[model samples]
Target chain A: MTETHWAYAERMDAAGLRDLMLAYGQDVWNLAFILTRSRDLADDVSQDVFLKAYRTIGTFRGGSSIRTWLLAIARNTSLNAKRTAFMRRTILMGRVADSRSSPSAEQEALARRVSDEIWMQVLAIPYKLRETLILQAKYEMSIREIAELLGISEGTVKSRLARARRRMMDAREEVEQDA
Target chain B: MPDREPEWYRRLRGNPLQEPGFTEEQMDRIERLAGERSGASRRRTESRNVRRSSGMEREGGERSEMGRSRNETNGPAANETESATGDRVGESHGYGESRRGKWSGGMEPVAGSGDKVRTGAGDGRTGRRPRRIRLRAAAAIALASVLLALGVWRFGSGGADPAAPGPSATQTVPGGGTATTPVQTPTPQSRLGEPIAVLQLKGMLAEQLPFSAEDVTGFEIYAARSTQALTVPKERTYVLLQNLYNLDLKAAGMTGVGPDHYLGSSESATLRIQTKTKSYTLDYDLATNTYGAFGGTVFRFYADDQVWLLMQGLLNAGSIWAEYDRLSEQSRIEAETRSNADEPVSKAYSPERLQVAGSDYNGWEKQFLPLSSGIRINDSYMGTSSLIQQLGNDEPEVLRVGNAIVFATDANKTSDGVGVGLTRDEVIRKLGEPNVKTNTRWDYRIGDYLKFHLLFEDDKVRFMTLTMPF
Candidate 1:
């Protein structure tokens, strides 16, 4: 087997770690953004993920790809960041505001771009389903890989995908009908 | 069996969601943190060596002096020294324990360790000699107690414990502290609001059709399993319908092919057209590209290669159309259940059963390999290069340079198939082991020479070559 990036995880120097960051920085940040739904939080989570990865590189057992491993870190970090009381209150407030039909300025801006609108739809799903969909679609992770990453069963992954797709189609139908 | 991704999914994959890039300052901060950590560890190692070499030479004198100083000053300066030393020792011990696989309870342990270390160092330097030694032992006991307490509190509170169960790593948040309250950290609300669905047409198909894609009301396709109402945009529905309208059987040179020529027993779907006054249904065989509409009599016309491809593209763009057979089985069961429930069986449908004809493998062979989006053996090197570039940045594994180029599959990017990204087992299961199998190359001999081969790296099919004999 070809040596994966994890081969150097245990003893990676600064330059080696920098290379890893450059390779997966965008991916890690993107996943963080998807989970947190906040760019600033994503930035923090990305930094923490890389630092955590570097600090604890020795603990990695090479069971999964380095990308998968880093993504898992990003996921956990984002979730933890969200669980902070400050984030919880902000999210609660945001949800309250969202309950109103008035779209936020950011939402209007996002709707202006078809691609951004697609991303918004993806983010609008419940966290679990949204995460599973992004992992499958954006990351092209196999059902098995997603299941492993999310600590869910393969059947759950498939079902979530079905539900997410159905929701997306329904949303698209609504938009088309409105148009 | 994995089905091909739908058109929307492919679009999403092609257009990656935007992610905010790391600022230069952020990069520098992380690098600095890494440097500090390495530096700290190196200092820790040196300190340990120094202590080992010196043994207890100055231990007694330092202890007496520490006690006198502690008695003389128990002020902010002492507190400062205590907290600073606590922080350093805590960080060092956290790193050391993480290496031993004992780091847990998130970053709390580091903080807790700092607290204990501070207490121990405080007592050792300030307390009477006997008390100092006793306090050291108590500090050790307290360290374990704090770790246990933190673990219990973490699980009990269900709070922001960064060390959630996942792939192993240091769970501690950098700059260890309890979850900050909202007042201290004013985080902004998530910008992404409620999900808004947007319609996106399949690329290239809308552009290819020579029709004003307006005035089309609705479009639906009848697949083997169930019918799907395609959500074609208002401006694009005509693009699809115009293709059907343009297939005029009465046009010049339009020849009627025999039922045997057009009709086949392969899978097919029907397109239903609805107008204000009338409705028409056209049946098209997927394998043969033969389509017919029954009016007074069956008008079977063979669609040209271009028209057939456009039709395929339309069908492929729809969700659930690609996995026709699988969904057919599922719907068959559902249909049986609905029949029992006295639901309308009219909605239940299957591919129109037609007379079996000669094999269509030749027609399939004339097309590109189904693995990739569009790649065929004997395609010009430049053409393949352009296609690969369009596919993505995945560099194909080139072996024995020729007209053919093998594209490597990226698990993170490419959809799973018997294509470049397929694992060894997947390729073997799809197309059995080759005639000649080496470490990195699998060659299948057709007749005499190797007609089909796959080059592997890291146990995944990197390059695939399939050449048809003349």
Candidate 2:
């Protein structure tokens, strides 16, 4: 939300940059984490996004909020990272690797009981729908804001939101039927 | 009782799913990378300034013979900066610390090669210049590839494949330009009747000018829609034409009747080439050639490269054209990445949007449709005023009523849901309260680049307009 910080970021010192990292680092990380659904992927992406933002600070024209611009950059970077070897390997071998990575009884118990099935279903949704839902339902972004951030028309944003809501409702219906 | 919120939606808004914060070690590495990038950006800026100053000093020399300036050819400043920055960065990033390090070993040679260029260019010998140029070109290509790769990944496309004219015999303008005119030797096209034609021509010229503007010596394109001017050096102009057709003016069916006049023809159109000639009378004698005063021939081509010989001349147009080219590419990539779902964000105004009758904002946006027909924007650099002029069908003077943009063009398109002449209270009654409101103004978002701003006078709608896309 501190959108004006980038106005002077071009000449900002290490201290200023550190302050910025502290201020907005969590939000950026969370955005990346939501998109990737992996903390480690979020970590790499958040760093890359900040480095890119620091480098391209001069290109920010002050026409939009700095947060919007940074989020846009994060979206691009995260998508690009998706094509890299690490991400591909992670996604392809993830279920097995995730089980292998945490074989303890406590981890299994936590996954079964603590984790919310609906939230997991939300993450399980396709990226485009999931992102649209997250931005609107979580961040409370307006239709216009989502369209602007995603670089799509407002009509498209509305359609995507409708589709995402329908999918969530269907998932809920299946869960209730099973119950 | 109030309806319970969706469990998933509430959880998304709550703090239960907070991801872990970055560790100290990750922050340190991130800081170091940011520092290196920032330092590189600073060095690039400094190098550009050095090149500009050095190039400007050697104004009368034939530096462009190499198709580049002396500073670019020498390239000491950039090389020096790169090497110095690389050393600092290498030390900070712990490059070469481990064989299987995250930092690539290829960075070392790139930095070392910078030093090589600085030393080689300082020697100033012709023999090794060829090899040096080749090496520099290779390095430049490598750097360009890296940047291009970044662009492709960022935008998920090959990136804006700008349809630039090949660097060949013909000298097509960089930005788009006029169509090859109809075959009439001296009959100029009627300007007033061909407003749309002229507008389209201007759009093309703006697009093509980016590529060929380097040929122009003077540029003044934004004065009036009817008149524009361009100039190029006499010798360069001749080279451009001669090389384009690969023929001499005399051999190409042209007769030089006067010192500055040549008449030529093709199968269809007659080409009249005229130049502004000047002579200096000698006051004193030189060793064996001339007198006290010396004159260099500067060619001035007037309007009418086509049939009637009308239209403004282009000045040192290449520079401006190049800027537009760069900015356009940036916009294209940004838009592509933003709208990556196969369907490009439609710039077209939907007819359905206009059908909303009884809305207060109706006529304002419908005003843009008729204006949008013939008014094509080649570059985003143009302002709202340029588009408004074409839509209103009024002269610039008549349209210059107030600071506010006039959205009252005569079109049958239905209103955008809101109309003019509504009071602040009435507008609120119809459209609900604006997202953002001030004492005298109200703002509402129609889309990303589209917004409505209303300025009120005495609680009445004094002016209202939609924001234009860049």
Candidate 3:
């Protein structure tokens, strides 16, 4: 009998891998964007992570959900992308802000609000704390699930979230004072 | 810090940082890339197999060297590592439990002992047996290949042409192209359309008129079911009968060869009918004046009196038609009763007038009230839209605003049902002039909050909205 993808990992054809990748495309793409703080880099990281997962799917065990496993891969891929000088230079020049011209006036306004200096402060926060907050606020991932995905302890996830929230609150206060 | 999140955080919770999803184009590109990758991987596996086979041949000369190599390659440590890797891979894909039974034990020694290898060196004994076994396997595979070719040659290719079209996918749409989809097979529920009623019923007679010819020269009188004869203009009768026959052809799921020629089949028999080109079958009832297929035995208009003898072999006694006629009459009676009981309430006749319209919407029945009379109950949005049932067929139903009554009147009704498509001027003329007229809306006030609003777009009544307190 022909072996299924489940029974034979290294023997899995590209179609099987592609079907698996399609399910988590959105989650991985959004996670990459939140981490990289750049849509262009997020696109690059998402493609790279899927290709990499296709190569290393055999190494994956059932210790975590496929989504969690893919997210773990996405986290590492985003971190590696962020460290590149090209991405660093883009961030330094404040060119990472989304500027895609939206046709709808309401959507454009909302995008502008999301890209405001307040969100920039959140981005300025350390990577670990920033990802923790984004996962909580944006994805609504629980502390335990975030810990399992990030390969960190639950206590570490909770502390990171608290620190991220404090920094964002303090940054908002400072902006108000300046205004 | 407050326990609650900030407004920014709250907004972020509800709406994630929106990212553009993978487009269809990207998905297609990904699939193409995957196919290429898999093809490359298969090529690599094929090359590996070739290399391994060649290596085995070269090592066949030295027995001891081959044994040592095999031990190194297929050792217990290597087997354990493979097992762990397989387990991990299987676990990821949800097949871990089934595979746990597999590879649970340690690998067997490739050569039982060094003593066995020494014994093999004395003679070329172990080598000759493997070569003979491989030869037998090769012969079996070759024989199977020959048999397969013979089978295909005799049965597969000769029996049927792979490319020959067996059946037409659909009917030929007259004068050229084939139909993209098949014609709908007739059913009892299918609306009676020209020629064939789909079902044999007396009610079908009411739909059309038929005529008879006095000169039965070419037409032989089959078992004549109807004795009374009616005359119609020969030219008109010919065209009408021809069209009715075409309808019958379609209803029978057959294509007509020519006028009065049809080829169709029932479960038990195939029917080929050729009646006189000018003549057609008429129903027994003269009032309905309908044309139908004539059959003293089968469902066809027979041109000869042989049908009388065939009628004796008939299995059924027209009970199906009788049951249908009885049900049709029963439904007609029920519809008449409903029409009388649920007659549209006149505005002058309504005892319940709006008291304080909006404010007095207490103790309102959440059921269908007599006020919603004349308005067709739109069951699609039943109790979904704010617990108030929406009325009308396709367009939104118009009821008197702040009151339950529907204004289904000549003044209110327009070409697009009640209160729709009427001009502001036309509506005013019909409803005896509006009590209030805004720039965009004309309101006919019945009470404090109850009113009929004629919403206008470009001075034409676009639609109407009733303001009921509910």
Per-residue lDDT of model 1, residues A1-179, tens digit only: 12365754566678867877887888887887777665555665677677666766786768888889888777755654433312112211111222122224445644554345667766655455677788888888999999777654687689878877876777678778999
TM-score per candidate, chains pooled: 0.34, 0.33, 0.29
* lDDT value for model 1: 0.39
**Segments in model 1 whose C-alpha atoms lie over 4 Å from true places:** A1-5, A85-103, A109-115, B1-4, B14-20, B23-25, B38-470
Q: What is the alpha-carbon interface RMSD for each candidate? A: 21.7, 19.2, 31.4
lDDT of candidate 3 over B1-470, digit per residue (tens): 23676787865543235435444454554444434453444543342243245332111111122122112222221111111121122111111111111111111112321212211111221212111101001100011112223223422344232221122233332112222221222111001111222344221221222321111112111212221111221111211222232232212221222122111111121111112222233322111112233432224221111111111112111322122222222222232122112322223211122222232122222323433332111111000011122334443243221123333222344232336566676765655454433445444444222234454556776545443321
DockQ of 2: 0.07
lDDT of 2 by residue, B5-122 (tens): 5666676764314334455665665666555552445654454344344332111111111111112223322212121111111111110111011111011111122322211111
Model 2 chain B poorest ten-residue lDDT run:
B132-141
* CAPRI-style docking class of model 3 based on DockQ: incorrect
Ranking of all predicted structures according to lDDT, beginning with the best and ending with the worst: 1, 2, 3
Give the number of the best model, judged by TM-score.
1
Candidate 2: tens digits of C-alpha lDDT, residues A1-179: 25676765555567766776776677677676667655555665666566656656776767667766767666654543332212112111111222212323423433453245556667645566777787788667788888877655687678777767776887788778999
How far is A94's C-alpha from truth in model 2 (Å)?
15
From the highest TM-score down, the ranking of the candidates is: 1, 2, 3
Candidate 3 per-residue lDDT, tens place, A30-64, comes to 77766766555555556555655665667555555
lDDT of 2 at B32: 64
Order the candidate numbers by DockQ, best to worst. Answer: 1, 2, 3
The candidate scoring highest on lDDT is: 1
